[model samples]
Target: NRAVMIGGTTGILGEWGPESEENRYEGAMTARQALAKSKNGATVRIGMTVGVDPVIQLCHAAGIRSPLRPFPATFLGSSEITLAELALAYTIFPNGGWRPNAPHILDRIEEKDGTVVWQSPEDRARQTVIKPETAYEVHSCLVDALESGTGRAARAKFGLKKFPAAGKTGTAYDFTDALFAGYDSSITCAVWAGFDKPQKIYSGAFGSEIALPIWVAVMNAANERYPAKEIAEPKGLQKVEICTRSGLLATDKCYDTVKSSSGESVHKRTTYVELATAAQMPTEPCNVHGEVRTRLVRDLPASGFPRASLAVDPKQVSPITAQGPVLLAENDPYNAVNSTLKPKPPPEKEKPETPSPKSSEETNLPDPTKPVLKAEAVEPDSTKPAPKAEAVETPATKPVLKAERVEPDSTKPVMRAEAVTPTPQKSPKQIRRAEPVHPSDQIPEEDILRPTPPPPSNPDD
Candidate 1:
């Protein structure tokens, strides 16, 4: 069954993000830990690896989009979306792997003394895009999240333990958005707290602190008010103990053994948690490597030391928002947050496959010596869709950028072409396709001057 995983980094990478001078925070964390900690780096890594298109496609299918561009951070609530929309989209996960529109209700059929009416049939379509196991796995990790990690405060404050629960919290950039979303086998609920005029919340505000308590309150009220019957836990599930740090089976030296509600340690018996989520928790140090080390410390913070990354800093999610053209693609923010990109090597003298250009062409185009993107025709269409595959784009259209993306692009030209030969300047209509800059070689004259759409940006050399 197909599944839709949500809540990704909107640009705030914590430990998992590549080290940078500006993005100072780095500490070892697993996916579960990253999510639990609301680590920016971990979320970005997961979203990029899984491919933003899949999750976002699901959100759009479920009708969710914010003013923020479709960058990686959008998955993290960096974008502006209504609380109502957020609630609706998250409900998809618990509806047995259904899309936002899956559980369609029919018109109310009524028969009364004064009113008699026939109703249209309900939309009864049911299919599994994701295995029931996948949903269960995601749910289970979230359940632990409320107990351990950042949500621990929520567990204690809200009295949410009355029922088994699972959910995620979000804090958007500038404290613009705060969200708490969770679901059970039978019921799903989500909530958002933010302002209409974009005022930042109290400096320490976050999903767990600002939003979760509200969710718990509503949930308990729901149990009493609506009184929906609980969904049964899936069968054949047994508790097990394993290292929360390394998803591997626990060793005698396991730093922390994950304990289930049954009080069984992961060491003695296996407890069901999210499958991919095992290595994701920061519960303990790695079995073999110990821990991924950097300047960041595992020691709990002192009073003024800052708690959550989102609350501590808004720039974690979006450091360089583009008020103009293109922002960094959510998945490719490696170049965005870190100012010091891997430096390219000096240009080498000669090469054959690249056509040595005439001096005249060189002058007319951008610098052949500098790095620029050139769109090359595909060797062949390996990306072709299978006949049976559901074709996503209909009446194929050219790949073009929307003139007005939600945010401006944050790209920089760290290296210039080695040769003096001018290459084409990238423009809105003509985007450049970036080619890897080899250590010894400069961009070939032919590659720089190719006829294609220019990139939205072209910083002059």
Candidate 2:
């Protein structure tokens, strides 16, 4: 059976036998240990892996005439079988893969005068059903069970240590049946203890507690006359060392360290169980142990103390997260965190000290003390002949500046402004009475050199 406490799965089938603290899972062990201890989970896992069909085919060849249901639970002996059929199947292991004849008591029958009428066969022939190596391996496992496993009760409880024997114990799911089936070199026996109504025996009524004592008593009395002996080792079989925990080959490091008397460290070796055949042994060493070593760092902390080293399994290290701080490239666009935490500086605003040449505020500002110029509309004489207008005559649009005006052409009537020299000797009253010219009435370039007109005569005079 495979080790169920390790990688084997029970699905939903929980504990099947008795409930006790001693029946709790104690982790993985060798197949021999699992078979000897009658571990239901381990046997179920093995049956599932090996398939129920193969086990059924093997049982049929070994003379087990019972019918088995097509289910994984059949690995735990879910099918029912009579004691004679079970005992007949077990005889194959002792007889080297051959079934023995059925039990018979009568030798012959005489008809009224001591005359032989019907006689049984002098020698009962056996049939070769399975390979000798297969039977030998199974027998070896049962022997180991009796030595230091659940079947140890044979010697402990029944005082049956004189015979060299091998056996297996069986129990139903709800304590309905308890059985003990075993054999020595000469004889084989099977015992069963249970209620006729198929009810629970007790809380912890196991096969060892209920049936093994009776089987031991029968074997003790039977072996005294038969004289028990060991079976010959079958050919095509070899022994190999295997690790108990992993069921693999033992490695050099599969031992614990202990201090010797001279303070030197010594390795206390682990137990190595041998399998029955070379085909049953493992090829790989146990992988549960790992190596540990110290590594050097390039930089130390500012505290001037060595950094504490932590041991990590090499298989579990990730390429992205197992390293120290990472240095990002300058053009890396991906950000690991929010950008709001590290706000960028606002763009610098550019302002020049000198003003531009085309600024209107610099060129249009006028001096307050300068005399203002004014534009006047000139009236042409109605008697004189006027000149023809030029083809490229200037447009009469209003000027935008306060000191400028549109000069008139000779043919078209227009308003013109004439320049006047500032009066050097003007009375205070005339200066106070002078009016300022608006920007809309400024003088044009063509009338800048014209003579100023005389003051208008008041009509009141």
Candidate 3:
């Protein structure tokens, strides 16, 4: 259950390529939990950890004859393979690490007279592809997937819970294809639904929606003939209580509690038991909780207060009573002695005393000590009448002068004024109009405009 970052782009080529189907950001979960949840980013991380070449080789050994590319994208089913091949590959899990032979149509052929004219070859011996412990672990995870994860509809919605079976649900990119491949001790089955030309079937068409039902129906029919049985736990495996948060041996502090929106406790429990091989069993107690507490203790004294001064009555601070349920973040304490103590609640505010309402007369009265001045009356002289205010006429009050309309003489030709286009001014300053020449000045226009020539030859004069 160690934290793994999920739903981010990862690949050698570009920023946009290879993203998880569901964009989860981060979570603390086991590989089995990751598998059950069908987390693409977690799966890609596993593939990178395991290396792409080994994964392809493992697939080949498990009966996937299809060619797989050596790339991280292949970890999320970028390579194409038939449903039959996939179902055959799943056989390795229930078969205790042994890869089964290719499925055949007939076990043997016989003549009509009951004398065998021809017969099928002897069954090929299964190949041991992986350790039994490894297979059982994967088988357990697949069972979890069927019971609670992507294939949960097979049990909850389709009523297949009674049967002991395990499977995975698959939905292709853009929901173009939906598939379900599963197996029991009795038989293996695979189902697929999609268009012949490879177009989207419909929006939100997941394998659990489209193909798991078919797989469930087929498995139910097969169960009648084969009588499905629980897959046996193989040897050399141990069960240990593991912290779901840290994936280490669980300690008392490794418990978790869930609360309702109203802050009521909903569920509370410590770690869950999980199967692990002798080599994989956790040796260390969960440090995540311990570290969190230690950090809180180390930082408390530095917060400008002595540890002794911060002590509180444990009876009043019981997490179960005061807080309902204690989450990891809420489990703040310096040591085991103080573990029951919770953070102090904010102080209650004191209510202000309401002022008495004042009477209207008292509120309206002026202060008696302050001087009150009154307006003085002035006597007017007998001979002088009060000066009258002059009437000031504004534009709106002023009378407008109207020009009289004169009738034009019809006998006289009326000259029409031609419309003139004004030339655009280059400069912003207004041009001054030339002054009209006086009629009394009879000088020639050229002589007036020309500069008077200096009297010819002052020397000759």
The candidate maximizing TM-score is: 3
Model 1 per-residue lDDT at 228:
48
Q: Write the per-residue lDDT of candidate 1 for residues 1-461, one digit (tens) a residue.
A: 01112221333332233211123343455565566655666677678888877877766656565544667866565656666666666565566455444433455667676464875565555544454555556565676677775667666776774666678877665456677887665557778787778787865467788888988887777776555445444443444455554455454554545787888886433222334333333464335434444634566647756665444653433333223332233233342323322246789986655444556744566556556565443333446643453335545465633343232234633344343434355433546799867665354444332223446675762
Q: Mind giving the per-residue lDDT tens digits that candidate 2 earns over 284-384?
A: 67655334323324566799876786698744542222122322323223331112122346989977646335457534655446877888775657666
Ranking by TM-score: 3, 2, 1
* 10 residues in a row with least lDDT, candidate 2: 1-10
User: Roughly what TM-score does model 1 have, to 2 decimal places?
Assistant: 0.46
In the range 1-461, model 3's lDDT, one tens digit per residue, is 12222321122112112122344334457788888887765787889999999999999988999999888878877688987888788889988999767766577767788888767787777888899999998999999999988888887898774878898887776667888889999888889899989897976677888999999888888788899888889889988999887777888777556887999976555578899988899887887765553322444445786556547775544232222222221233433222232245599997985655657955576655555565453444556654555555569967766445444455775454553443332333557899868566354343322223546666767
What is the lDDT of every predicted structure here? 0.55, 0.68, 0.71
Better of 1 and 3 by TM-score: 3
Per-model TM-score versus the true fold: 0.46, 0.54, 0.57
**lDDT at 210 for candidate 3?**
91
